[model samples]
Target: MQTNDAFSFLMAWAAAPFRIGSVTPSSATLSALMTKEVGPDTGPVLELGPGTGPFTRALIEKGVRENDLTLIEADSDFAAMLTKRFPAARIFEMDATGLRHMALYNGPVLGAAISGLPFRLISPRRTRLILEGVFANLRPGASLYQFTLGLRCPIDQTLLDQLDLRATRIGHTLLNFPPATVYRISRIPVTKSYDWRYA
Candidate 1:
């Protein structure tokens, strides 16, 4: 999609009265807003709230096959748009918090989670709960890629502290609306959480 389309998409989302924070598409920030962790080449990939498929397009451009990607969006309007936009992708009309409830064991091991959800206003508890579900289901070496407006980190630090997850600032891209920074989150050293994948 073009930059103008991105702007229009964000504007519509902004007007939705949804909890979604920014409607701005950070296509330019897609690459920078990702962790260098999730190895390229292959693995089942999950994208949260892929508004207008901005990062979804970038992920395909970065070598992730359309079939290997799963696009999840809670917005019915946006979900319908994604279904038409990327016929090759698997679009889920659901919220990120309820991901674990969805049965997805038939695909490749989850290697990465690229979240564009409005996490700034989201509480750390809810964020941790969602991440816990994602992490528990991920494979070893899997990574969570999140873009944030604040140039500081991907997910909030206070949330990180509460979840016992450690995040490293991989990179940042200022070309996006309000700009953003990407962070890689993983279990800090060793934390008992029934999943070694996050460790």
Candidate 2:
């Protein structure tokens, strides 16, 4: 596919009703961020809002089995597009917050969530809710991959503390527009509370 075609697809989705605010096509850096950290996608990998599936495609190309991919996309149009693009992968038309209610695979899931959702623009309550659901659904040692143009992800420290999620900078993508940083946050035992990371 031409670069413009792929670029247009991502731009259109980000501008759609869902308000997924990516200013550019997902960068190569964004796609590579988690693959290097997830280290061998041997189990089920859940991708949220896989708009055009940049990360999904990367994961598949890196050795993840087609059947082990479960994508949760909120946009019906995008979900339908993903279904066509990746017939071997499972697609769910649900929001991230509803993850706890869904049926998951029986085997151990790879504790990595590749999030392309626009967390910086979303409300704190909504963000926290989704993180909580992710925490509950994923086993310990599972990590969340999030990238943002801002120096830090907009999630508040209190929210992170409440969910016991700890943040570690995986790397940065200076090639992206406005540049961006990637973080791999995992759940850890917390003895003290912290103020909101956003605050």
Off by more than 4 A, model 1: 1-4, 31-40, 106-108, 191-199
- Colliding pairs, model 2: 156-196, 156-197, 156-198, 157-196, 157-197, 158-195, 158-196
Candidate 1 has its poorest 10 consecutive residues by lDDT at 31-40
> Model 2 residue 141 lDDT?
72
Q: Name the runs in model 2 displaced over 4 angstroms.
A: 1-18, 190-199
Q: Candidate 1, after superposition: displacement of residue 163 in Å?
A: 3.1
| Candidate 1 residue pairs in clash (backbone atoms < 3 Å) | 10-23
Candidate number with greatest TM-score: 2
lDDT against the true structure, per candidate, is 0.73, 0.74
TM-score of 1: 0.82
lDDT of 1 by residue, 1-199 (tens): 4766676676676776345677666655555456345435747788888877777777787778888788888878778888988999888898788875665665337878888877777777777777877777667767788777786664667777877777877777767677777877766666546777876
Residue 195's lDDT within candidate 1 is 78
**In lDDT terms, how accurate is model 1?**
0.73
Q: Relative to the unseen true structure, what is the C-alpha lDDT of residue 44 in candidate 2, on a scale of 0 to 100?
A: 71
RMSD of 1: 5.2
